[model samples]
Target: MITISGLTKVYESRGRQVTALDGVDLHVREGEVFGVIGQSGAGKSSLIRCVNLLERPTSGTVVVDGVDLTALAGKGRRAGKDLRRARSSIGMVFQHFNLLSSRTVQDNIELPLEILGVSGAERSRRALELLDLVGLADKAKAYPGQLSGGQKQRVGIARALAGEPKVLLSDEATSALDPETTRSILQLLRDLNRQLGLTVLLITHEMDVVKTICDSAALMEKGRVVETGTVGELLATPGSRLATELFPVGGAATGPDRTVIDVTFHGETATQPVISQLSRTYNIDISILGAAMDTVGGRQIGRMRIELPGRYEENVVPVGFLREQGLQIEIVEPQDEARGAAEGEQAEARDARQDESQIDKQDAAPAATAPALVKDGAR
Candidate 1:
C-alpha cells in the first residue's frame, strides 16, 4: 500500500521554476495494480521517482507500507541508511532497461543482492530462482545486448524483484516495446501482482496498459491528478473523462430539436439489450450515433451516443425510464452544442502544443544528465 499527500516537485529550467508535480494526492491499496496515466509533462515520471525518494519532493509526504519515507528522507540530498533500507522493499522498473551491459542476466539480477551483502551461494540461488520466476531461466547466461527488448525488461523485472519487494513501481516499463510485447509485459505484471501480492504503481501514457492490467487508475493533466477511481466506478460515472477517453463514442446532434445523450453501461446492465428495450417500451425510434464496448477486469463495459426524435424536455420520460434500468446518461445540451464543439477543438489544439513542447524539451536535454541509480538499479 502507498499514500502520497500534497506531493509537489519543482525544477529550475532557464532561470524559471517549473512545477512537475502540483499538490498530487494519491493512494494505492494493498495488492492492487494501480496505474497513473497522463500525457507528457503531466508529472507521472516525477511522481514515481518521488515514491522511492529517487527524486526528493519539493514538498509532500510519501508513506509506503505504513512507513513515512519523507520523514526518513529528512533534509539530506542523498538517501540515508533508514531511507535506503526502506527503498529495498520498494522495487522500481525503468522505461529504459537499466541493466549493466557487461553483466549477464543472472548477474544483473544478483547485483542487488550482492550490494545487500548476500552471500555468493545465496545470491546465485536467488538469481536463478528469479530468472525462473520471470520465465528467463534459459536466458540467464545471455548478456543485455543479446536479449530482445522484452527479454531485457523481463530481466529488469527479475532484478527489481531480487530484493523480494512488497511494492513495484514501474516507470513506462512497456513503452519501449511493441504492442505484442507490451501486452505480454502487462500480463506478466498482472500475474506477478496476483501471485506475489505485490502492490504495483505504474506510470504510463498508454491507455491500453491501464485498461488491461490496472484495477484502479488516475488521470493526470498539467501536473495534477484530474480523475482517480476504480475502473468500474469510472465507467459508471456520467461524463467521466477517463471513461470517455477509454470508450469514446463520438457524435453530436446533427439537427435541431433532436436530443443527443451519452449512456454508460456496466455490470449486469452491460449484458442486457437496454437500448432495444428502451425503444420498444417507449414506442420511440432511437438512432444510435456511435458505440464502443470493451472488457475491463473481466467485466464488459460500454458507452453509446444516441439521438432521440425530440428535445431534452420531450425525451425526459424516456431518459428517466433508461435511468430506471440502471444506465448512466448525460444529456447533451443543444444550446451549448456549437460552443462545446469549439471548446473541444481548442482543447485538442492546446494538447498538441503542450505535447510538442514537452518532446522538444526532452530532446534538448543531455543524455548524460539523465537520472541514474547508485545500487539496486532497475536491471
Candidate 2:
C-alpha cells in the first residue's frame, strides 16, 4: 500500500519555477492495480518518479507500507541509506526498457540482487527463477538486442522483481509496444498482481490500459488529480467524466421538444432488458442516439444516450421510474441556456485534451495504434 499527501514537485528551468505536481493526495490499497491517466505534461510521470524518490518532492509526505519515505529522505537530492533500503522494496519498470546492453538477460536480472549484496549462487538461482516467472526462461542468455520489444519488457519486469518487491511501479510500460503486445503485457501484469499479491501503480495516457488491468484509477490534469475512484463506482456515477470518456456516447437533442439523457447500466441492470422494459411500460417511443457496452472489473457495464418525446419536466415521471430500477441517469439536454453552455464548454475541454493526447502519441516513435476498448476487462 502507498499513501501520498500534499505532494508537490517544482522544477527550475531558465530562472522560472514550473510546478509539476500540485499538492497531490492519493492512496493505493494493498494488492490493487491502480492507474493514473492524463495527457502529456499532466504530472503523471512526475508523480510516479516521486513515489520511488527518483524525484524528491519539494514538500509532502510519501508513506509506503507504513514507512515515511519523505522523512527517510533527508533534505537533499541524494538518498540516505535508510531511503535506499526503503526503495529496494519498491520496483520500477520504465517506458523505455532501461537495460544494460552489454549484459545478458540473466546478468541484467542479477544486477539488482548484486547491488543488494546477494551471494553469487543465490543471485544465479533467483535470476533463473525470475526469468521463468516472466516466461523468459529460455532467453536468459540472450542479449537485449536479440529479443523483441515485448520480450525486452519481460526482461525489464523480471529485473524489477529480482528484489522481490511488494509494490510495482510502471511508467508507461506498454506505450512502445504494438496493440497485441500491449495486451499481452497488461495481462502479464494482472497475472503477477494476483499471483504475487503485488500492489501495482501504473501511469499511462492510454485509456485501454486502465480499462484492461486497473482495479481503481485516478485522472490527473494540469498537475492535479481531477477524479479518483473504483472503475465500477466511476461507471455508476452520474455525469462522471471518467465514465463518459471510457464509454463515449455522442449525440445531442435532435429537436427542441425532445429531451436527451444518458443512462448507465451496471451489475444486474447491465444484463436486463431495462431499455425495452421502460419503452413498453411507458408506451412511448424512444430514440437511441448512441450506446456502448463493456466489462470492467469482471462486471458488465453500459451507457446509452436516448431521446424522449417531451421536455425534461414532462419526462420526470418516466425518468424517476428508470431510477427506481437502479439506473444512473443524467439529462444531457435540459433546455436551459446556462446549463447547455456549461455542458458545451465541458465537451470542448474534453475534445482539446483528446487532441493533445493524439498529438503526443504522434510525436513518439511510430508503433501500431490500438482502439481504446477493454478486451478482457472493463473500465
List per-prediction Cα lDDT, in the order shown. 0.91, 0.91
lDDT of 1 by residue, 1-379 (tens): 8999999999999999999999999999999999999999899999999999999999999999999999998786878899999999999999999999999989999999999999999999999998999899999898999999999999999999999999999999999999999989999999999999999999999888988989999999999999999998888787688987889776768889899999988889999988899899889999998899988877888899899998888998999998999999888776556766777799999999999997787677687644543232454
Clashes of 1: 0
Worst 10 residues of 1 by lDDT: 370-379
lDDT of 1 at 344: 77
- Total clashing pairs for each candidate: 0, 2
Model 1 regions more than 4 Å off:
335-379
lDDT of 1 at 167: 100
The positional error of residue 152 in candidate 2, measured at the CA in angstroms, is 0.6
State in Å the error of residue 151, model 1: 0.7
lDDT of 2 by residue, 1-379 (tens): 8999999999999999999999999999999999999999999999999999999999998999999999998877788899999999999999999999999999999999998899999999999999999999999899999999999999999999999999999999999999999989999999999999999999999988888889899999999999999998898787778888888886677778888889999899999988898899999999998899988767788899899998888999999999999999988845443455578799899999999997786567344433332232244
Model 2: colliding residue pairs:
295-378, 296-378
